[model samples]
Target: MLYYTIWTLFYSVNFHTSMVIMFSHINHKPFLGAIHDSLSLLFL
Candidate 1:
């Protein structure tokens, strides 16, 4: 039971971290674009 609990906790943490990393990576390009647009507007 203890082993199962530990495994579940580990799995959940790993899953959450991977999801966050992937989400950030996926959004990274769009985020950069937004920043670029804002900078361009500022310069304009």
Candidate 2:
């Protein structure tokens, strides 16, 4: 249980920071597009 909790927090923060960085750049268009498409699919 402790391991799971630690991993969840780790991935959450890592993904959050990576996402923020991805959004902050103009050159990472494809990554941003993929993220947008994935979000749209989830909503649909």
Candidate 3:
């Protein structure tokens, strides 16, 4: 039971990390674009 619990926790953490990484990657370009646009607008 202890081993199973540990394994489950490990899998959950791994899955969560992968999801975060994937989401960051997916949004990275758009996020950068937004920042650039905002900065340019402020400068203008």
**Which one wins on lDDT?**
2
lDDT of 2 by residue, 1-44 (tens): 99999999999888865765666464556776756754676589
The TM-score of predicted model 2 comes to: 0.56
Backbone clashes in model 2: 0
Query: Whose TM-score is higher: candidate 1's or candidate 3's?
Result: 3
Q: How close is candidate 3 to the true structure, as a TM-score?
A: 0.63
For each candidate, the alpha-carbon lDDT, in order, equals 0.67, 0.71, 0.67
Q: How high is the lDDT of residue 11 in model 3? A: 100
The worst-scoring run of ten residues by lDDT in candidate 3 lies at 29-38
Tens-place lDDT per residue, model 3, 1-44, is: 99999999999888755655565567775555655654566589
Clashing pairs in 1: none
Could you tell me which residue pairs clash in candidate 2? none
lDDT of each residue in 1-44, candidate 1, tens digit only: 99999999999888755655565567775555655654566589
Model 2: runs farther than 4 Å from truth? 27-44
Scanning candidate 1 in windows of ten residues, the lowest lDDT window is 29-38
Question: What's model 3's lDDT at 16?
Answer: 58
